[model samples]
Target: MTDVTLMDFHADWCGPCKTQDPIIEEIEEDYDEVTFEYVDVDEEPDIANEYQVRSIPTIIVKNEEGVVERFVGVTQRDTIEDALSQAGN
Candidate 1:
């Protein structure tokens, strides 16, 4: 099985990021096999830079192959789930 990971790059004061939190949380419960990572842009600027995240909320779905999908701003749960599915989650 391919190892999949969902990375959420956000900051504490970002309103859109706040909106995206619950969606990610819900996905966490649904996709127990996929690894989830919440990266605070303030605390982890290097990681954000590595991902080239210029927006408040950037969601990256990747697997053993590479990045399968990427979303910016407030993304819907279904869209994320679709990306995860594409990544072999």
Candidate 2:
């Protein structure tokens, strides 16, 4: 099985992204095995567009094999925790 990574795409000025950022931080504490990557849309538009992020706060859960799940907008803690569990984090 491949390692799982969570990609969080957000902008500095986004309100909803502000809300989601903390959740990711909290998740980081609990799921240390899961890798988290933060990308600023403004700084890296190409990466964001490649992921098809039409909105801010797009959370992409990917394993080494491929993408597993995607959460757009403000993702709840439980949902993300569950995905991490499934990803073998």
Model 1 TM-score on a 0 to 1 scale? 0.96
Local accuracy of candidate 2 as per-residue lDDT tens digits, 1-89: 45889999999999999999889999999877789999999999999989999999899998876788899999999998788777764
Cα RMSD, model 1: 1.0
Error of 1 at 64 (Å): 1.2
lDDT of each: 0.93, 0.89
After superposition, which runs of candidate 1 have C-alpha atoms over 4 Å from their true positions? none
Error of 1 at 37 (Å): 0.5
Give the range of the ten consecutive residues with the poorest summed lDDT in model 2: 80-89
- Give the per-residue lDDT of model 1 (tens digit) for 18-77: 899999999999888999999999999999999889997999999988899999999999
lDDT of 2: 0.89
Which consecutive 10 residues in model 1 have the weakest lDDT in total? 80-89
